[model samples]
Target: MHSLETVILLLVFVLGLALLAQRIHLVFPILLTVGGLVIGFIPGLPRVVLDPSVVLLVFLPPILYSAAWYTNWSDFRQYVEPVIVLALGLVLVTSLGVALLAHSIIPGFTVSMGLLLGAIISPSDAVAATTIMKTQSVPRKIVTILEGESLVNDASALVLLQLALTSVTTGAFSLENALLEFVILSVGGIGTGLALGFISFCIHKHAKLEPALETVLTFVTAYLAYLVAEHLHLSGVLSVVTAGLFIGHKQSRVHSPIVRMQAVAVWDFVIVLLNGLIFILIGLQLPHVVNAIRGQSADYLCVYGIGISLAVVVIRFVYIFMADTVSNQIRSLIHRAPIFPSRRYTTLLAYISMRGIVSLAAVLSIPEKLPNGSPFPGRNLILFITFCVILFTLVVQGILLPLVIRALAFGQPSTDYLSRHEVQKQLSQRALRQVQRLIDQDKLTGIAVQAVIAQHQMRVRELANAETAPLLDQHQLNQKLMLTSIQAQRDELINLRDRQQIDIELFHEMENELDRQEIQWHPVSG
Candidate 1:
């Protein structure tokens, strides 16, 4: 077991590197990964041999939940077709193409082994994609599609991987059975997640706990969705995502002001730290993977890794283009809307293949030996190739994506904030009108209306006049000022902790309160 001090030291290193990454305006995951590689080669530092189980249990649920929580359901539904095609169809195509290539090129690799490897690398990491996209001037629609794709693709890939692994172990493969199982598990996971979400909502509604307890209950909801789904042999990833989406959709109606206030801050804290550690863990495992590849010649390994990486990249372009052509042609024949396939956006989407620690965890989860006690076929080569593909995609594709965007002259930034804020302001006015109706009916006093609706009136007026002001996130003009003050207070608290005027525990509690306040104040559009 790793000691407490070792874990703390690793985290401290991650923190320092994170600051450096921000200072240089580099993506945090990229730089932190490189930092990890550097530390991995050093002789004296303790080897951070992370278990596959740890990453699965600790990192996966929170990371998936965070993405699902922030995903806007309306946008998801509107773009359901494309999201499903990419998340479901593209995953299958990529896996099959990789499997075919691996089975053909690599010596002594079975179809099942190839399938397992393909599934391991198929799911694109949106965190890595977003890190790249955020630095560039990508279009908002492309970003949104990539984000939505990343949220649910793991379910498709993982389920496929499990089936392939079972095939490899049992020396049998059944396509019809796999499809039926996929349907059952996927549907069951969705049902389980929605049921769990309902249970959480009811618990929060009836328990009437304080914000702290409610926050804990929300965490419980997330873990339960994953664990219970897995216990029932369903897709745990999908379950957690489904639950997160359900709760996020109903959040405003169900959660109290205080619960809403605390949940975001708590989740933010959990996700960032968890993600940072996983990246560092990714970096730390480089040596172990490199060592494991000694069973094969380096030349063969490099050729296979680089060849399959290029093939997968090429396959994505082909599949997307084919999907676009086929969908558009069918839609035209049926006299319906086009597939909304922008050439430039499609090109950008094709480049969002940066895999992350998830890939590593999945690859590591492969067993060392098969059921009959013989070593798992091509296991070492799979490990090395998985590592190589991840690094190449993360570094090469990640760094070049922005340059490509610039080349296409399509890096212009856009936001829907102003339009959404205008809509919100309009709704607030209608609400004011409703209040006026109540006053006219003598149900509410006019004086009371004026007192209660001053903020609403100010917001509408500010939005009306703000054609010149740089658009901020909220409809209310004062939101920026409030955020600035909250940030200043947060800094002050950190400074106090640094100066040792407060203990770390006290500092965290006070800082979390400020964080909760900050989150609660952030503008949301319906």
Candidate 2:
């Protein structure tokens, strides 16, 4: 088969596996990583080549943007200090710690090489953490803190990585200059992202395009922001993230529902595919990495991998505990200060530091040669170690995370029924208001007003009855049966439309009524 055709087939297969795995309540991200590893071992599979620059440019933007856009900005702002500590401060500390350890432990390894390795894996992958944590019923605050930290940490890590790499390449290391450059890059990146976001937002507002067209524009915006930031020698990851956050927050107010829905679906699919492909690429590169270390003691690679992985894991645990302690103490001193609310939730957040595609991509990006025209020391070993660490965290840690939550009794009780009821109540109230307004404005005559009022009153009564019903009792079995019947009918009608057995206009009219009825029955909260 042609290379492109082969890749298309592989992606289709991976997506199929993802769907099946999700059905059984397995985590899709970990499944993909494992699938990639298994596929990599197959001798005849096409190799997945990745240029570090291309990986960063392609994957980082949409992933970061999606996290930022969906993130609760208010919560993120409230917990900004802790997020910064985890994202920026923790990344630097981890990098330094790893560098020091590697320099001491690995024979003939320079501090610069050690720091480069440190920088490569310093930032945890947001996509991995968000995907894994999303399936659990964790508190919203903890989720927000993790999502925010993951989005921004890459910027910090990458900036540090570049500075360290420059020093290593030129044999000139200056702490003062590195610090100065870090500030300039960060400021420049944020400015670029904001500017790009605003420009994209303006274009979306002015152009009355099809939903598909607007979705395309969003894709374009991600890449454009990255390229612009990179050209200006700033952190591309930060720039794309900022633009996404800006656009996502404003998208709802500006775009039509059709555009918003279409864009969200498209972006979601893109991220999944991109993430899957990255993991697959990591697995595919393993053969080459192993070949690079051939004739060397495989035992040494094993030890090195274990040591580095342990270092990364231990450092994160220590850093999270320290940071949370300090943050809690500070919050305790101020009466008006917001608290994290739950220590157990915070600990779960610490355990969720699973590294995935981004770290692999960064490790894969290591230069082939150092400044002295010799091969970069332990480059293959680093890649091997990184892949091992990612697997251990993503597969081992990912699988065990739920058990940890359960052991700690961290899962929030299911709120699905309450949420559904709340929605129903809000819709019923809205409908009543609309009918009353019509009568007041003389839009309905006496007979029409009475008929409308009767229907509205009936809905209100039904909602009230449902609200007062014992949640776990079978006394209101008939009402529950009726609700299920109505829902089933609605689903059947939707299926009919999907099967092309109904016309669009008729389907929509019926669907709207069904929605109204469902809303009245469920009574959701705002």
Candidate 3:
């Protein structure tokens, strides 16, 4: 099939699977992966080989940026310590454990080679985990830590993979140099991200670009962060993530509401499409991986795959429990409460070790051949094993995570809803006071002023008694009536435009005003 045709087909496939996934209450990533496998094995279909470099360059930035963009900065700051432990410390430990397992299991496999493989699959994917978690009633802290770890962990794993690759391919290694390089890459990437994020913020604040242009710049900023960091031989993943974090935090203050809304919608769709395509592409790699390692027996590869997959899960479980214990002990010594994560929370955290795009991209990016013109040892096997790990985690754990959460019944009512309600109430009271002062000063006048005061008073009362069922229902009905009135105005405006009673410019201005009002009434839908 031609390139365009192939892309169209993939999109259709993704859309179909997404719908099916929704109907069946399954995680889309798992379904997409399985769908890709089914279609990949279909006879006479085109064999697709993804360019590893393209995957890193094109997909990584936007995906990382989007994840960072949505992450709650306050929550991330609160959980910074554990996020660091998981992103840096746990990643290294998991890599080492997988390395040991691979070295022991595979004949002629060196520790460095094993480390290379381990690093490729060490970082758990946020896309899959967050998507699943959003559908369930998960604790807010778990969500933040997982998101923060995902943002940082890829950089650490990539650094380790690079070092291991260097050691394996060149037959030379230096621990001190490697450590120094990791620091430089991480720090430099973060610096690059901050610099770019500031630049983007200034552009949005000062330039006052229109919504479309501002949205476009977000994509450009993401790519620029990654590309610049990579060009500097730093951690591109870290750069993208940092840029995302800074931009996400500042955009609300700098960018207009239209820009924020448009960007959110665009980013959400693009991320979903990218994620779906990625998983499907992962499944499609099976045929090529198998063909590449034709010499290895099926049974042999299966054993390696199963063993390595099991090792990855076991290592995470062991590390998380141990870390929890140590952290709780220190907190107790300092007279702080033990943070009170029961075994259930810890188990959920451990089970959230699903690997996705980054791991597959890293493994695939491994050199096809060494400098000496020999085939890269176990390249195919490593790819196969990585594929197995991705498949197993996404399919098995993804399916079970929801069930587990349901069973565990994390009963923490979301504090976010209550906080928002309180804030709304406070804002309404302030508005009412301001309106009263304006009337007293004669700065505002007429029936409109009284109407505005009445609206504000009603809002304050409703929010204050938000827990009362009758008042809540009244608020909902008020919103519906307001929306209906807005719709009627919109219809009249459209009718005037159609009958040429109003010029196009006036029509558009009126339409935009209506849109602004609609957003106030139904912010999420708008």
Candidate 4:
């Protein structure tokens, strides 16, 4: 089949599997991956080769940007300590542990090759963990830490991977040099990202571009941050992440409402497409990787795969416990209060160590040949093992995460709804007072004054009732009834269009107006 035809078919497969996943209440990534695997094994199907550069250059920047963009900056800052432990310390530990295991298990594997494999699988995928957490009421702090870890760990892992690859090519290793390089790259990447973000902000401030162009510029900023950092031999992953965080934080202040809304919609659509395609591509690589290492015994492959996967998982679990203990000890020494995450949160964190597409991309990007013109040592094996780890964790751990959360009941009962309600009530009361003050100051007595005061008073009353009732308040009840009525009107509008009683343009205009109304009323909590 033609390449375009193959892509179209794969997109169809993505949609179909996504729908199936929704129907079955399974995480879509797992099902999409399995679907891709099945499709890959079909007889005479076109081989869809995954280009590593395409992944690193094209898909990664936007995906990472979107994740960083949506992250709650305040929560991330508050959980910075644990995020560092997981993103940096735990990743290094996992890499070293996996390095030892890979070196011992694979006959010809070097320490550098082992480390390369280790780094490839070190960072857990944020999307997989967060997607599962969204379905459950996981604690806000846990979610923030996980997101922060996922954002920062990619840079650490990728940097280590680069160092390992260099060591393999040179047949030399130096810890002091590697550490120095790591610091330099990290600092440089961060600086570049911030600088680019500031520049983008300036452009938005001065240019006054249309919403569509502004949305386009946000994507441009992401790609530019990655490309510029990579060109300068810095950590492009960190650069993209940093730029995203900076831009995301400033967006509310710098961007107009229409731009923000449009950018969000565009980014959401793109991220979904990219995420689905990425997991499917990861699955589709299975056959090719298996073929690359075909001569190995089935039992041998199984042992290697299982052993490595187990090593990564167990290493993380142990590290989380060790790190938390050590953290508490240090806090005690410094006379600071301990037990922020608690034991339960630590256990949940350990369970969320599922690897995903970044691992696959890192492993697949291994050089086909070394400087000596020899094929890179253990390249095929590394790819195969990475796939196994991702599959094992994603299927086994991802499936069990929600059940574990329910069993533990670790999520806190959030007060965000009540807080929003309180704020709304206060605002409405303030507005009413302001209107009365303005009317008295101007010595005005007319229909306009009565209209403004009445609107504000009504809002305050409704909000006050909502607070008192807490659940199913008069405001909420009215919201539901209003929505039901709107739905009936929507049905009638469609029927009118079907009967040719309304022109297409008029129908579309009315549809958009209804959409705006729905958006306005949907947030009935406040």
Per-model tally of clashing residue pairs: 0, 13, 0, 0
What is each predicted model's overall lDDT from 0 to 1? 0.73, 0.72, 0.77, 0.76
Clashes of 1: 0
Ranking by lDDT: 3, 4, 1, 2
Give the TM-score of each candidate. Answer: 0.83, 0.82, 0.86, 0.85
Per-residue alpha-carbon lDDT of model 4 for 245-283, expressed as tens digits?
Answer: 888866655665456667878998887777677667766
Question: Which candidate order results from sorting by TM-score in descending order?
Answer: 3, 4, 1, 2
- TM-score, predicted candidate 2 vs. hidden true structure: 0.82
Error of 3 at 252 (Å): 0.9
Candidate 1 vs 4: which has more lDDT: 4
The numbered model that scores best in lDDT is 3
Write down the worst ten-residue block by lDDT for model 3.
468-477
- Candidate 1's residue-wise lDDT over 375-455, tens digit each? 877776887788778777887887787788888677455543334344334434554555445456665444434544564
CA RMSD of each candidate after superposition: 8.9, 9.0, 8.8, 9.6
Give candidate 4 regions above 4 Å deviation. Answer: 411-418, 426-449, 467-526
In model 3, what lDDT does residue 134 have? 79
lDDT of 3 by residue, 245-310 (tens): 898866645665467668878988998888777767766767877988866788989999999999
Model 1 stretches astray by more than 4 angstroms: 135-137, 371-375, 411-424, 427-431, 434-459, 467-526
Candidate 2 per-residue lDDT over residues 1-526, each given as its tens digit: 6878877977887788788787977778788878877877888877766665476767777777776766545456666877898999989988899889888987877888788888888888655566555666666566667777887887788888888878778878888999999999889989999999999999889877776888899889988998999999998878988898788666645665456556767878887888887778777788888888855687877787778888888888888878777877777788545445666766787787788767866777777787678987778877887887777878888889877777768556432122444444444555566556646675555544465466556766777778542221122323333344345545555444444344333444454555445444543401
